[model samples]
Target: MFVHPAALCESDQIGPRTRVWAFAHVLPGAVVGADCNICDHAFVESRVRLGDRVTVKNNVALFNGLTVGDDVFLGPNAVFTNDYNPRASVKKTEDDLLPTVIRDGATIGANATIVCGVTIGENAFIGAGTVVIRDVPPGAMVVGNPARHIGWMCACGRRLDADLACACGTHHGADPTTGGIVADDA
Candidate 1:
């Protein structure tokens, strides 16, 4: 891993080809996977786990209890909260914190606020400045305050048509169990 001179990477668990940029702070016990780009001014807490090929953009703060899957893209200034009810006087333990899971190939847009305990499904796309209060389904495209699901997206990052077909030649169908879109083969 290549840690910039101005960056403070206390973790020994960073994988190969990962680059920690200037002013970024990756605390000890954080597990960062290979080929990840930790942009400038990002803060990664100790308990966070980042999968391979993840892109954490500038000014992002990844707190404890966050699990980022492979190929996830965290946009600049995206916010994540770990506590549902936070109080300065109350010192809560790690177990009290709720976990947020960002599934593989998901893209969290810039300035979006993701509330704790929600699972963003695979290839989901969160629009910029959106506030996510609940779980997002796979291939879902969400926007606005409280994060309404507006449409479906392909894993290749293209919006799916009414028939859930993308120009990228991928076809998806709604999963009956979860009401989420999934590839036909999946």
Candidate 2:
């Protein structure tokens, strides 16, 4: 569904029930999944893949070579870049671009600038205005410039206690080998 007649949704790959809001421009090769919300003035570049139920807020610019997993929350004006050294005079091909991956259930707060080639792990929460320069571990809550991990988050979006238990009744612990968060059934 295109919310505004002015919105240019050129993508035939947009799934059913997705909403592209005012002034949003979804390029032809972009793939937006079902029930996704692309808010006003957002730009989805070609070859970008947004999984189901992703929330891209106003003025967000999702460049090419980025893949957002299911249920991701991209706060207003969140930026995803593709080039590490973007020179206006140097024309770069798609092969020269870097890719960024936002894992399932991750929340990138408003105005965050995510540098390309980084993987934001599942259920990670990035604070507003933070600039992410590296990979974020799963279930980690990071704030401040360059985004340091302050704590862990539950899949339910609640902060986990020191005991690694969330009020939502989910238990998560660090995976020593991978450095990612994992559900602890035991």
Candidate 3:
């Protein structure tokens, strides 16, 4: 039940356990689900919709036309822009707006900037400080700017080894090698 002084919202769909922190604003038409944490200084625009168990950390902004699925972890300082190309003096129309979607169970690390019109797949993990300009596949793990898929990640956010396996049951059990896990399945 923690409410920040700077957050202004009139949305009626906020879940029970969600906390809105300092300087964070959820606009009137935003829909946020249960147990989501909107951390410090985050801005969620009116058209943004967040599903259950989403975690939006400090300094993150979800502009209009963004849809975040359930169990998504948006790391600190992550940014999403609704426009693909913009000049400081240009006025864009709704037709020019792009939608950014983060699928279920995705984890975006700190300082990641996801460009418009990208759909991050389910359970994909994007490392910190990465810049994503393309769609990320499900269960994939990517890092660095323009984010190349380096490996696969478990739904738990553990990076799978080169053997396409981990100590976790996911390594040698159900859900094997689905996230572009390439290498020896040792």
Q: How many angstroms is residue 157 displaced in model 3 relative to the true structure, after the best TM-score fit?
A: 1.6
- lDDT tens digits, residues 66-107, model 2? 999999999998989999999999999999999999999999
- The deviation in Å at residue 50 for candidate 3 is 0.5
Q: After aligning candidate 2 to the native by TM-score, how far in Å is the CA of 161 from where it should be?
A: 0.7
Return model 1's CA RMSD, one decimal: 0.7
All models: lDDT?
A: 0.97, 0.92, 0.84
**Which of 1 and 2 is the better model by lDDT?**
1
Best by lDDT: 1
Q: Per-residue alpha-carbon lDDT of model 1 for 1-186, expressed as tens digits? A: 899999999999999999999999999999999999999999999999999999999999999999999999999999999999999999999999999999999999999999999999999999999999999988999999999989999999999999999998888998887678999977
Q: Return the candidate ranking by TM-score, descending.
A: 1, 2, 3
Q: Relative to the unseen true structure, what is the C-alpha lDDT of residue 38 in candidate 2, on a scale of 0 to 100?
A: 93
How large is the C-alpha RMSD of every model relative to the true structure? 0.7, 1.2, 3.6
Top candidate on TM-score is 1
TM of each candidate vs. truth: 0.98, 0.97, 0.88
